[model samples]
Target: MSSLPITLSAMDTEVRVSLCPSCDRSISCTTTVFPAAEDFQPPQDHSSEAHGTDDASPLSRARRAKHQACAIKSEIARLKSLTKELKAHHRSLVELSKQQLALVAPVQQLPVELLHEIFLHACADEEIMLRTIPYTILSAMSFSRVCRTWRNIALNDSRLWTFSTIIDLSALASAYSRPRGSWIGWDEVSTFKRLVSLYLSRSGCRPLGSLNISASYNEPALKAAVDEEPKLLPPSIFKHFHRFRDISLTNSVIKWAELRVRASQESLVKSVKIVGHNEPDMSTVLFSGAAHLTSWSQYVDDFVPVNLPLSQLTRIVTGWISYIPAFTALTQCRALKRLELSLYREFTMEEDLCEPEILELPHLVSFRLCVDNPCILDDILDILDTPCLKKLKLSWAPYSGVDARLTDDFSDWEWPKDEFSRFMDETKCKLESFTLEDLCIPPGVEVELRKQLPQSTRIVVEENSGWSDEEDLDLDDLMSEISKSDSESA
Candidate 1:
């Protein structure tokens, strides 16, 4: 084998190595011994020497030194190339070792059934499941991308694909304004529709837990597209209407009317919520075919007329309605177990053409009312009768004179104790829990009210008047007094 020779030299405590062409083995030399100063000889002047003489001329020596330097540089380049190859080989070996270790990893050894259960739990994390636009699909996609095993598990599990699906068609409306030839082309709407179709298909035959669809065509930019394609949702969505358990429609009046007309009688829908403004006459009764619907919620800027199977409903939550209409709706819900209402106006002269009769809800177990006018609550208490009432929550609406009611001493405020006492006596229903929210009540009055209720009943008094427990002077003392009264009552 041919080997490149190496020469090592030391001078003034510095060492250097270079290739030696004259020898096969490496040569080493050290300049530890130095001549005495007096015997030291200076370099000879070779400028006057002839180039052909036995001694080398200065130019010849310079050329020889240059050749030596070039040889050293060539050797250095070869060694560097060799070093790079070695490093790459080392990296490959390390990666191979890691792969071997991973084969024996504890997590990789877990049974496929255990891994599937673990993945299910991970998908159900509150942080992932409770998002405004839920990340359930995104999380499942991520898990499937991890490895083949996980991909098969996630894709085959129908439960992973049946969470709430929120379709915001307003996004489609905004897409029309994008500059021409942008990322979202004219076919963007069809692409989104296909995506929704695919998402629903992935759910297989599982019931969709909730479907929230919101769309608004009020934007002037969408007028042309609206004329071209009146419907933003894919027709495939309606085919799955029988799978929906809860449906929420916001500002989608036209779509809502269509859905009500096309809803399957076999729909598993149990809850319905509608939120909109200036809704057109939806002469079509809402959810008339949903025999399983037990809960209804409505929020509207204006009073949109609604006709549904009210007798079948067990829960109703409504925002801001006139007193007469509120009472009229309650009368129809004989099976209602829970009722929540926010009354905006008292009875008008036209609405109260006849004397108000008692509104009886025999099956009502819970009642929550928020009134803008305190007198409205007084009227409700006068006419309301709930024989099975167990929970009652009353609060002042935001528009009510809450600021005026909040006082340091609550000396100017007094709860309608007489009306409440009369209602309690008339209903003859034992209340299990009573809550008073956003109301300023004198400590003495609170004590008196506590004395009237059974000791076993739970009473919660919340005053959101910016007064902390410590700032409320003598609140702890009043609480002790309440305890004493409870003991006496017992």
Candidate 2:
């Protein structure tokens, strides 16, 4: 028989149960039925007619949402706290990195002795030092930037006190005094002051070894300094006579009187070089400044007027205008071992008169003469009086009549046979090497010159005025063929 549908008939309570068919186990659940009409009285079975009780109450749903909102708020607070902590940690790390960098940066620590050794190295290889390393080191100011220890070491290092020989003293002073300098301007000034004081205290400027001042583009700053503030630089800067060993100046407008006044105090300046567009009037101050100059290179509008009684002077190199007079003035330099002359725009026929009687350099071991005219060689060979002359280089262009000024025929020119033969005989024992470039000689000349040699002399003859490329192999072939013929004949 089919079970009849049952409905609860209680006033306010109701219950329902379903049974599993196999086990007869009852599964409990609840449901409520509600009145459909709005204006109805309680139904007879009120337990089944409570419609609102079947759905979740608004208060219960609201309670569950409140709990979920609280949970989400807690999660957001936790994330914000974590983010703040991470930021704090990153800031600390950055600060620590900065501290570490400050602590570990490389610093110069060379002592005075070590610095002196370094300076010695620099002095030995002046080209490399001036061209590369010193500029690089000074450019970075690395020594100045390190901690107090390095700064102190660098400041106290006397080698650091030295400046480039080619530098402008005025510019250097200005840079040292500028407000925005790497080191405080006062600090640089103080350092320079201390160095000057130290150098001056010991025998005035005796400790001041070398001074070089130069300016280009016609800047008048240094000259102004010398003139206006002769006292600004330590009188020791000029007054200490006899300590300096070298002096070089170029394109300078300083007066000779001032130079002599300054140099009179320096007893030891031995090497001097003066160069510029216009030569200084050095005649009056020549021997007055220093009598011990061993090496001199200068350019004068006229000949060197003053004779320097330089007994120790061993080398003389000059460019332009007054070489004959300059050589005559160098007669006192009996110890001179080398002579170099660069004839720039020959000024007179007097220059072509290279007479041994007038210019005698008996001790010269090496001689170099650079000129355009080959005819000058005749005069030069006649005047070569040095029995000790070992090397002779003549850079000249033969008269190929290439220039309209030259003649194709030079047969009419007579050789000074007596003077030439005497010079050859005198130089034969000493001349060990000869270099001739852009030169031409009659075929018999070379053989006769070689026969006069006391010992084997190495002669190099470069024929063409222009350099020949490797593809021009005809000369090489001719040399090879000549060598073969010589071997077969031998």
| Model 2, global lDDT | 0.51
TM-score of each: 0.62, 0.54
Instruction: Please provide, for model 2 over 1-490, each residue's C-alpha lDDT reduced to its tens digit, 9 standing for 90 to 100.
Output: 2232334434234533222222333322233333224323322334565576744444555565565556556646744664565456558767998888776653234455674465444433221111232233442135546567655554555444343223344654444446775543445434444444443443233333465655554455555545544433434444433454676665343353356354435467677776655545435353455656778776533445354656677987766543455445565767889877754333333544443353467788888886545455555566556777888877653222235332123445433456668877765536677765544444345445555554366665555422332222223344456679889999
lDDT of 1 by residue, 322-347 (tens): 77777777788899999988886556
Deviation (Å) of 24 in candidate 2: 77
Q: Model-by-model lDDT, in order? A: 0.65, 0.51
Candidate 1: worst-modelled 10 consecutive residues by lDDT = 126-135
The TM-score of predicted model 1 comes to 0.62
Give residue 240's lDDT in candidate 1 (0 to 100). Answer: 82
Enumerate residue pairs that collide in model 1: none
- Number of the top TM-score candidate: 1
lDDT of 2 at 277: 52
